[model samples]
Target chain A: MYGWIWRHLPGNVYVRILISTVLVVGVVFLLFQYVFPWAEPMLPFNDVTVDGAAEPLGTPRAGGAA
Target chain B: MALRALVRTLSETCITIGLVIVLFVVYLLYWTGLRAAHASDDEIARLHKQWAQGPTGSAPAHEGTAGGTRDSGHDGGTTGGADELAGDGGAGDADSTAPGHRAGESFAVMYIPRFGGDWSKPVLENTATATLRRGLGHYTGTADPGDKGNFAVAGHRRTYGDPFKDFPRLRPGDPVVVNDGDTWYTYTITARPYRTLPGDTGVLKAVPEPVDEAATPFRRSGRYLTLTTCDPEWGSSHRLIAWGRLDATRPTAEGKPDALTREGR
Candidate 1:
């Protein structure tokens, strides 16, 4: 997927490099600002808390008291 | 031969630039979060130490008692225990004497059992990047803790410990507790955090609803808490809000309140 995109980017080596750099950064900025945060639910993060004193285990969605 | 060698060197330079760009992305997405998390931990530790060293300049954090600040309303100091009357029964004025609640200062420690028993974050004074990067920041213009208004705060939904990452998981009636100078103010989540536009500052109001200034005054009478973070977890187009109402308050000297007691049920 990446290789194909690299070949299609028109320009001499230097211009191609500049264009690729800009494209990569723009895409990354968009992803970081929007795509990544939106994917938080599907991501495996926030499933566990790092409690140093206790046995590390996954916790259920804690909603109720105690 | 020289031209071929020149071409080879140019290709190497291009590869190097690409590598550098990749590294920059990693730093932005991953390293920055790690740094922010560490900074937050440090700030929390500092606040804890400062509070430990300073005197809690109010009435004891005992139940059903307003520690009698000259300006803090003392009408309903009787809302004590697990049944702290929620509708403005005992919430007092924002303790102005506490230096922590001032802009750039770390005021309180927020504990949400629904997030995790060990999950605690420092609540800073302002909403600046430097402040929010450390922990949750109390919106300066909003009500302070235990006040008869919205004690609104903002935090990073995805980074800087992602303190509110599980905010959506918090259901109604869950406890959202804060430890200011002396009291552990326990609030109950009102409902799942609803969404709103980024410009909607009205949700931070005491009533937790939008209002038009041309129609009515911009304030309400209640002890509410508003937690806000970016919406969609990946974008800043909107906001995700979690609203809670103050339910209980206990003096630090008396030990953890009933809401924190996780024994049988």
Candidate 2:
């Protein structure tokens, strides 16, 4: 995939490297600022609340105090 | 030649995928923390500016009444005690002190002595995902600071600046102090961190536990506080809860509460 990108660049090796660096940075920026945040809610790490809609852990009385 | 090209493309695709996955993890672990730290700092600064502007007296009287409607369902007997403490002009002005109840609005600052002397986070009004990213989030429908019911707040245990990173470190008698730009309400942790599942919304109830449970810290709601966070540091399979009871209330003008002072602990 990267090879195709490299081959398609219309520049000398030095300029190609610069363009590649910029592209990489841009892609990372897009992933971090947009893609990852859009994907985070689907992950379990931020589920701090005990909402009824969340998946049950099968232990009906896990809370102990219920 | 075709086979060689196919294998090269497949390997490159795999390498790209791996790099992206690693980068995503980095974003989740460190980049998110960096962003959240800025967001939290801004929120705290914004809250301080709002407080400095003046008291929250101009807030609609009907909105204050509406906010208190939930607490009315609890028995009035215990409510009077908290009300009296909250009624005092300096510390007890719970009704008129909250800035706004709008979702995502930050209304207070919380300090957990156990978390660290420098540890303080703005307490926002709701627990929405985006809201929690800014700072600790107050669960909507719960009691306000120094009020008669459970004043529950939730924070991330790992990412989003890890507001509750040391959640499990909290123990009974630890102090969780809150300032609503008016009063400093100090609550003493009444129990060790209780491990529970995410679906146990009961833990946020006015009375957290059942009446018969010997472990129940609160028999009836007077002035309670609950702090919750994702369990296991890096995962959210479980939740860790710490319950607290309002121990003291003082006007912000009195300076920092004893719980927050260097000599208090």
Candidate 3:
């Protein structure tokens, strides 16, 4: 798909490559500085923060309640 | 001529892609590492200055006066609080969660001898990525070191000087020592490092599961030290944790604690 887009771009090979690189980098910079932080709260990166939640020891001893 | 132009376009695209991949490698591994190293160095310098000038045994950043526990025992010397930072061992936890103890502020120093004889990293107040770049960051809302709950911290496992790179090398009973300016809190590694998902906050709790009331810090049976880092060294899909139980606390004035003295462990 990207190759098809590249084939259709105007200008010589070098100019097109330069334009493509610039566009890609710009998008990446925007995502890192703005998009990622904004979306982090909705992500699973920091779900468990404090010492309040628990995981089932699941390895309960005999007669231990689940 | 048409075939030649097509070939030229394809080659140029391939070379551009090669360059992009190389640059991305440099950014991910070397660039971030270099950036974090500089940030941590500056943070270390700032902490040293604070230790030098800030009043020893200073009040917690949030509340309470120095007078609340100005003499919370551990003051063995009759000459008054002249030699060490605070030199007292009371529940100085009063101000641990104070708002002033925000991210980026270096609050303690983590000493893991396995890293090096002089391996001491600043312990920042929060575990945010920016804060971890500075040094190991304490998890907010957890018990402070020597307190009866979990004194948890997180750090980069691979980048930013790889503070916890040798985490798996710690065996049960290895000492994970922390210095909070005035006192040394020693903890012993409890079990093999545990693995958990990033969302499983259960490991951060005072008790791992079921919230055993009897195992809480209030009952004094729940003291813990947890060190977390991204597992597998190169990804963050999972987390590796080291658990420890508080072993001892000694006033800095008392000189180096047994853990530091037993450095080979």
Residue B11 lDDT, candidate 2, scale 0-100: 92
Backbone clashes in each candidate structure, one number apiece? 7, 2, 2
What docking class should model 3 receive?
A: incorrect
Best by DockQ: 2
Give the winner by TM-score. 2
Model 2 lDDT tens row, B70-122:
23232222223233323322222233223347767888899998988888899
Say which prediction, candidate 1 or candidate 3, comes out ahead on DockQ.
3
Model 3 residue B114 lDDT score: 66
The sequence of per-residue lDDT tens digits that candidate 1 reaches over residues A2-64 is 455679989888988999999988977776566644443333222121111011111122111
lDDT (0-100) at residue B258 of candidate 1? Answer: 71
lDDT of each: 0.61, 0.73, 0.61
Tens-digit per-residue lDDT, B33-149, candidate 1: 787778778877886687688754332332222332212223224433423432234433332222234566777788888888788888876665556657877776566676566
Candidate with more favorable, higher lDDT: 1 or 2:
2
Candidate 3 — which pairs collide?
A51-B205, B57-B86
B29-138: candidate 3 lDDT, tens digit per residue = 66556766787777778766776776433335411222223222344233244335333344424333444455458877888776777778888776555566567877
Q: Candidate 2's residue-wise lDDT over A1-66, tens digit each?
A: 787899999889999999999999999989998999988777777877766411132212113221
What C-alpha lDDT, on a 0 to 100 scale, does residue A13 get in candidate 2? Answer: 100
Query: What is candidate 2's CAPRI-style docking category based on DockQ?
Result: acceptable
> What is the C-alpha lDDT profile of model 3 across A1-66, one tens digit per residue?
367778988899999999899978897777545654444333232322222222121111111111
Per-model TM against the reference:
0.64, 0.83, 0.66
Q: Supply the TM-score for candidate 2.
A: 0.83
